[model samples]
Target: MNKVVLVTGANSGIGLALCERLLSDDAEGLQLCLACRNMQRAHAARSALLASHPSAQVALLQMDTSSISSVIAASQEVKLRYNRVDYLYLNAGIMPNPHFDMKAFFKGLFSSNIITMFATGEGILTQKDCLTHDGLQSVFATNLFGHFLLIRELEPVLCYAGRTSQLVWTSSSNAHRSAFNVEDIQHQRGTQPYSSSKYACDLLSLALNTHYNKQGLSSSVICPGFVMTSLTYSILPSFPAFLWTLLMPLFWLIRIFTNTFTLTPYNGTEALFWLFKQKPESLDPQAKYHSLTSGLGNNYTEPRKMDVDLATSEALYEKLLQLENDVRKKLKEKQKESQHVMHHGSFA
Candidate 1:
């Protein structure tokens, strides 16, 4: 039987590659759902995949992770379509209107390789959409809170299914512990909202593992090394990306010394694809997988320092439950208010 897989942001990048790779695997067939915000792009992606593997089962679902209504609607659609989801890949994210510092970029170029890629703020950028539909930062909403809610909504299917299910989150090496402040998960006080969002995802993944693994649901995180995806293209201007592309050979050499220098989407997604072959119990629930590249351009998978504190992870889980309840209560109150208005008009 085929496994039902739901991949968010499957229209492009690692999500698309993961869907293609899953379809190519011979162990089982896949009922792959590409949950994306853009229907046209999702259609094109679905068509392209079906062209190569005509027998591939593909479905498109419109979802904007920044909106609570969109998440709820998409989850309801999934519940109606599939009895169970064996795999859930939370891959949709945003770095809206990133401000890349060119001076920092050149300064890091002259520094040591590690500093150039990891420590320095050259490759780092700032996002603009700190406001979401839920009054949170758009980055945190799409990357963390929205997906958190999606998982909550789909828990019945993922956890109580006939078989075990896996939830893989596309985290980042740049997700430093300091980037996240428990007090302000929205990162309203900082310019590095993307990093903050990723950090929150790290904590959220840990929380999921701790809370739900015993219940037969497993959650893990992976850093899709620096992928040259459409996301990257959008963040950096064409000229910079082109320049970075030209330096691809140098990047491969750097990958030998620094694991975070993964320069391609395929290599960046290696860990994500590799995890698909494993049983949930065999994985390290507390660790985040790193998608690394070798010196010769070969892709490899490794484990990096996962900054997961159980206390913090648990705290976040409780916070999420409160947020979910609050959102539901607010929605119910609004609906009742609207109904009262309608009833008065009809009586009048």
Candidate 2:
């Protein structure tokens, strides 16, 4: 009866690294549920992990954080498979339309690329997704709202384990001071929607902590300092990413000066991996954990100013409650009508 931990985006990047760290810990004996969008990648990741820790119990469920229906289905699967959920790492995120200013990039190079990227998550200038089926900006939906919906759907299982259960959100240091306009939460007016979405997650995570901690759900936010992941790889053309890989070692030198520069997925997940070893009450509700990589590739933690207004967070929580209720009601009505029609057809 090992504690169940569900990590979204567990197929690659920091999510995958964190999964390995958790399973390798002989003391915890965590039963990992790798919630990933691509089943093939999930299976491959599981196979790779199994080669090392044969005794590890890892399950895969297809979860696209961008889709509300997918989140619901994945949560239902989790409910069916597990009796209790001890940890929910909401790590699936997207940086859509990361247009980088080449002139600014070159100018900042002499100073600190780590600090420059920390303020603006431009990893070597890449194009972003322009379309999403949800009719909203893809980044906002996938990075923030989708994870929010998954947490809402899994509230039953998450809260079943009591007050100790944790919700760790993978927020970012690039969550800029002015990235999010509370009125335009979708960031339709902005180019840096990814930063805005991460900012929204910070706000939402704080909201969850303030309102739900008493209800047995504790929420925290962590940043995986710029990591070389598939997400980043997709941002740029093949040539530039390849070129950047050559200069990655130099980035580590810059990382020491600026604490938020983690180059690898393993280093990026330090904050998240450390949280698994901590008690909920021991964490600071307002402080966001920053994962850092030293010049020598050693991992370290730092605290960042999580610009969270509790009053606004509470309002967002109330709004989410109304939205959740509306969605549940519509779903229930459809289900009841379907059942009635089926019953009549069977008898007639």
Candidate 3:
């Protein structure tokens, strides 16, 4: 039997790199599905992957992780196309209007926390988040809730009696417990919605393991470290792309102190690809695997224990379920309104 793998946000960056790696690893018996919002980019990604591995099975599914309806429709499409999902990579995420604190970076450089700041990007970075059409925080919706809903929707294909399925999330080192609040799960009042959302991914993975492990489904989260993708380049938008190239030497210097600077998307996907080859049952649920690059440019995966507890994880799982129910109600109402508008418009 052929293994089926579906990856969200697989058009570019680490997601795309992971796809390439998967094909390179097993081009014969693997069916790859690239789930992306942009059909154009998805086509390009499929073409590029085929260019290298012409015999590889690569398909595309259109999905916008920020939209509830889009996720639902895409899930239906997925179930229609594939009976079983061997691997699901929840890699879609967004960090909007990022603001880098150069002053804090400099301060941390002089302080004893320089290594931590560089590794985690905790003290020197923030993002301005907005509300989605569903009235949820855009960062939270794109990064956490959307993926959670996708998992819930695909439970039938993911959970089987004898077959095991794996879920690998593209989490971040910036996922801090301090940024997350159990009361405001959406981070509506916080400036660090990106961090909060990633932290939520960590907790949700644990919850998923607890709930679905008995059903032959396993979930794990990974931090790609600080890869210089378009997402990272957006942080310093004013700086030209060439300027980032000029700073490569500095990044290498920092890599000596902090191995989190994986730099390229391929290197950043080390842990994701590593997880693909592992038995899900043997993986650690309480750990967040990290993709690390050394000063000499060697890449490896490291498992680090996350700062989460079972109580918090279970509480977050319940909160997400409640939010999912609320969103379903809202979507049903919107669909009915659309049908009603069409019914009245037909008479006109």
Candidate 4:
């Protein structure tokens, strides 16, 4: 039987690159589905993949991870379309209104923390986060909660008795424990929602492994390092695209100090693609795999122990479950209210 692989945010960047890589590797053995908010881009992605391998089984599912209703509806669509999910790549994420700290960046440049700053982007970056229609933090909703709901919704397909399903998240080296607060799991009060959400992904992966491993479902997270994709372009909206190309030499120089500058989507997807070929049962729950690029431009995947604790991860899992219940209840109430309005208006 052919393995079914579903990837969220597979329209562009590392997500799209991974799709291409997978098809190039096994167009016949793998069935690919692109779950994206923009069906237009999804179609383009499908066309691009088919341009290479016309026989490749590529499907598309419209999903908006930031919306609770959209995620649930998409998950239902997925369950109806596919019997089993072999690999689920949770690559949908957003980092909006990023403000680069030039002062801290220059200070770190002359200080001893330059390499650390470059690798993790800890002190130099922050993003303004908004709330979704569900009243959850947008970054948290798009990057973590939506994926959580999808996993829960697809538990049947994911936990098929004999076959193991792998969940690979596109996490980040920028995921900082300092940005995350247990009390504020949604990071509503934080300026670094992107970091907080990625950190949550790390914790959630471990927690998921604990709960789902016995049922043949495994979850892992990967840091794509610092890839210059459309998301990166959003960081410096003032900078022209050509200016980024002009800085390629400087980016290469930085790669000598830290291998985190994987640069391109293809290079950044090394860890994600590597995880696809691995047996999920063999993966370490406490580790976050990273995509690394050497000075000579060779790409490799490295597994690094994450700074997450089981106690915290489990606590987070519990909070997410509670939030899920609350959201579903509110949704049901809203649906009833809408139906009441429609029924009353019919008589009017």
- Please list the residue runs of candidate 1 whose C-alpha ends up more than 4 Å from where it truly belongs after superposition: 113-123, 238-245, 341-348
lDDT of each: 0.83, 0.80, 0.93, 0.93
TM-score of each candidate structure, all chains considered together: 0.93, 0.88, 0.97, 0.97
**Higher-ranked by TM-score: 2 or 3:** 3
Each candidate's number of clashing pairs is: 1, 1, 0, 0
Candidate 2 per-residue lDDT, tens place, 26-140, comes to 5247888999999999999999888888888888999998876788888899899987899999998877555666665666676645477543455544435454665556887
What residue runs in model 4 are displaced by over 4 Å at the alpha carbon?
A: none
Q: Name the lDDT value of residue 217 in candidate 2.
A: 85
Q: Give the TM-score of candidate 4.
A: 0.97
Candidate 2: segments with Cα more than 4 A from true spot: 111-114, 122-131, 161-163, 325-348
Models sorted by TM-score, best on top: 4, 3, 1, 2
Tell me which of candidates 1 and 2 scores higher on TM-score. 1
Ranking 2 against 4 by TM-score, winner: 4
Model 2 quality (TM-score)? 0.88
